[model samples]
Target: MATNAQLGADDDYIVVRNPSKLADLLTARNVDPEVVTKYLHIIRGDAKDCYTVGKTLYGINLEIADMVVSDVGGSTVVKPNRLRPTLDDPTICQDVVSNIPNSLKRIELLFKATPRTRRKPYIVVISTTGISNHGRDIAVAMDKKAMEGILLREIQTGGRGASVIRGFTAVRPSFLTDGKPVGAQKIRAAVEEEGKVAKSAIGYTISRGDVGAWIYEELVEDNAAGELKYVN
Candidate 1:
């Protein structure tokens, strides 16, 4: 079990797309909900589109920090990605509209590969930004029992965005050239925090779209490790 505070050197930070999933993950890791919530503050209970990038909150440019969990009862798993949404794109109605079908399909596969369990795995979405109408629509669509999960990411009106948005590892780093590293100090800093670090490091690197890809790999790896098991 891992707590929000008890991170090891090799520990990788994760983001989930749902709340109930988050609760379940923390329980498995033996993390206290009060403590987890303390680390996370709710901005908009609803949905909106936006994310905070870096120390300053950015508009459409955003980041998602998450925690992934394995279900105890059922092979179904829940993943939570706490985000800071920004409504910088007024014309667009929101900043980000997550690729819903792709995400759901990934979950669907994970569920099928792992045997059935009493614990129905689902998603738990949290947003520093408010939830958008689109986000809500997606959530509703995903609420089917067969899917039997959720999607709850959004942006808020004006809650304290500082704590909620900080300490997050970006899914992608802003700089990377053929596995070689090249970037400004800020990007370097972000990559170091997000990925594995070396003692005699040459430099830092991260790809923006690579975060999701990496997460997918991790999920499969977890399955291989028996974190995702096959029950009779």
Candidate 2:
């Protein structure tokens, strides 16, 4: 993430994760985590509140850059310039707090920070099928359906902030498989404003790596086919 090393660019980069685990996260992306210290700005715990935008602004004078890519597993409730928690509890208002996965709650940062951003960050969310009145239902992946429901409901809510987000694309890929990169070329993908959701042609499966690469192409490479410019 540092200065767009592999992709070739000089930009201030800030990626936060536990120091011990940071290496693995970067390594998964084919980055040499060992040398990251030379480029990345490491955030030690408690020094900065990366959650609440109000508090984080005072702490870091932050900017989420030109784009915010959210790969969160579950959907979140994005408040519309509206009320939020007093103590940063994402699981606060849900009737089924136990049902809300940690992944879903964690995305609270994505929703909260993006709206307040002066830079109109192009937001990309990896969603799943079965989000009511949308993609076909995936009976086996119960978790996916649940998250999709929550996401769609909240986004459709009257005062939700996430709806106001610009350049937002919710990629609803089918059952995600790991271990090998099948590549997006092997699968069929359809894009539409509302006519043909990607989930419609999701097929049986897609690789996580391919999804990531697709994102890299759309944002970093700036594919002429699609839009949004992040310039890695």
Candidate 3:
């Protein structure tokens, strides 16, 4: 495996020829920045941190390029460019599960172990079951993690295979004015369910409306590749 020191310059850019070389160069034991950067390079981006290099089969951005690198004993720890994960827009279901540890307690443990950066490190759990009608996946893991006082920031229900029904009807509620109204009722139900899921997932109380900003910070605006802007 080719290490970072072995990398060659390609017209002002550093290139790592071998893909597997990155794993060897980076220690998987913890959040290493050097490993993350090498991982980013292996994944490839335009001018480093300009845009995510890979995508999942679902069109989700898989490799987030923007990262904060911390030098740790000849290694680097790479994390989301920003401390938080975004979730405001409702359209982009951030897939942060891969970045998280296996269990819910593992998340809390990891957060406590890692050193704090400029921003507070809060964990946002996105439900991968992909059940939108069940409400946003962000809430479940978020709530579980927040039980320790971490804050559940934002919730979104529904995804590619998810539904957005508003509410449930008890015995049709009068079949007057056409059944088309039922459709609207379902939509409302879905929206309301999303809210409920968000609340349920948080497991703790947050300042009202703050979840929106937290979601936007970690998810949408903090583009991984966008970090190149500061590199010069």
Candidate 4:
């Protein structure tokens, strides 16, 4: 089981939408309820909306350093960039000296400071239907080889924004429908096994509540540690 401390408070989790579901699951499991309330963080965007999802998920930012330039003949010449921490840059030494106290200050600041933006391991929920050619008959359509290909290439590429984190467990669930909580017992989950399909692995339609419970029971509880799993 990964602790909030091991995975920093701010960066421990990267949920996409309806983070409340993950929180609800964690609470039911008797894990630290406050962990979800205080530490569980989310990437703000919709995965379906690819256009701006990356910016929202990663919170893109840019910093421009001041550049030194001189006029050489008719052209403006910019100074060559120097390696950081070189003898020419005394600021690097100063930074090293200052970081110790700053580190201590950061610890103290954690109590009041807004959670810093950092990447950590994540359990990403996605659709098996996205990869399967068949709609409800995805079980037959998704073979072991096809599952591997979708996970490796398609999912990897589409989810590249969240890939910067340590790693992620892609939870490929069957058809999802809104209803009462199905409870963890009703859900079936397994690692990417060849020949596994919707009917053989688990049921076809899974409730959103059950999906949440499965994430907590299987992925989070077992400490999946970055792997792909199918659930229903």
lDDT of 4 by residue, 29-99 (tens): 68897666575445543333333232222222211101100000111223565332223332222232222
Which is superior by lDDT, 2 or 4?
2
Q: How would you encode candidate 1's per-residue C-alpha lDDT over 1-232 as one tens digit per residue? A: 1112122222333223466776786697688877766454423322222221111111111221223221111122333532422222222211122322233234434444543211222122111111222222121111122111222221122332411211111222222234432223323221222233322322233542242234334333433343522110
lDDT of 3 by residue, 1-232 (tens): 0111112211011223354554564454354765465444343322112122112100121111122211001112334765444444222212322122122223234344443211211232222212334454433222212211111122123321221111111100111122222222122111224334433332222321233233234332332223211110
* Candidate 4 segments whose C-alpha is farther than 4 A from its true place: 1-5, 8-37, 40-123, 129-151, 154-168, 195-199, 224-232
Which one wins by TM-score: 1 or 3? 1
Candidate 2 clashing pairs, residues 3+ apart or interchain = none
Q: After aligning candidate 4 to the native by TM-score, how far in Å is the CA of 76 from where it should be?
A: 55
Task: Give Cα-based local distance difference scores for all models.
Answer: 0.27, 0.44, 0.24, 0.40
What is the TM-score of each predicted model, taking all chains together?
A: 0.20, 0.53, 0.18, 0.40
Q: Which portions of model 2 show Cα errors greater than 4 Å?
A: 1-17, 28-30, 38-64, 74-117, 135-137, 141-164, 192-200, 223-226, 229-232
Worst 10 residues of 3 by lDDT: 166-175
In terms of lDDT, model 3 sits at 0.24
User: Can you write out model 2's per-residue Cα lDDT over 96-169, one digit (the tens) per residue?
Assistant: 21122222334444556654333333334566554534444465332334433444455465544543223445
Q: Pick the lDDT winner.
A: 2
Name the lDDT of candidate 2: 0.44
lDDT of 1: 0.27
What order do candidates take by TM-score, descending? 2, 4, 1, 3
User: How good is model 1 by TM-score?
Assistant: 0.20
